[model samples]
Target: MDNMVSTCPICHQPTSPEWYFCPNCGKELKAKLIKIPLITQIGIYALSIFLPPLGLWPGIKYLGQKSQEAKMVGIVAITLTIVSSVVTIWLTFHYLQSYLAIYNGLLTNPSGLSSF
Candidate 1:
């Protein structure tokens, strides 16, 4: 009977079945599994677009992985989150500035209200 064995990609050493890591070179023997599922990916995208702050967790998780697809999703989610945050801050500052200007005008010209 012939015995079956696998070889390590890094060191080319014969490895037994069911071994996850190469004993000779310490490289992982198993193929990297897709950690992020389709439904979860869709949810991440949706959260990034609608609720940016909540999307950060999945974005960071995906970014930490080795998969290129996950990295792309992570980058997109992070970019959207940052863009949303910046837009929110800018809008808030602009509206606040407008309110302050209106308040100042009211204070300086109390009779301005009569023109309305």
Candidate 2:
């Protein structure tokens, strides 16, 4: 397996894989002209741009619990839905954790570990 350089069709110049378009002629040689269905690509691109999981956040979050990855996504969604502030985090916590972590008892004992 030898690393061979690819030559651009437009300029006939040696190109590296990193070279997206030919630097000489500025023509797209490595560009594969596959067309993604507009609606589907738009939806995914929308999610990636508006949502954080468009990156690799979900995969790492999924390591602990796949549902939590969903929660992380939901958290991002909830944050956007709410007025942005430290209060937005409270909304996210309320949305995700719900009534599970009762505040009444925990407020007095912050960690809530004092019960144990």
The residue-by-residue lDDT of candidate 2 on 1-116, one tens digit each, is 22367788777888875555788989885444333355644454345445534423432343334342344444544443333434546778887676556655567667846657
Q: Using TM-score as the measure, which candidate wins?
A: 1
Model 2 residue 113 lDDT score: 67
lDDT of 1 at 18: 61
**Model 2, C-alpha of 80: deviation from truth (Å):** 36
Ten contiguous residues minimizing lDDT sum, candidate 2: 55-64
Compared with the true structure, model 2 gives a TM-score of 0.26
Residue runs of model 2 more than 4 Å from their true location after superposition: 1-3, 33-116
Q: Backbone clash tally for model 2?
A: 0
lDDT of 1: 0.81
Best candidate (score: lDDT): 1
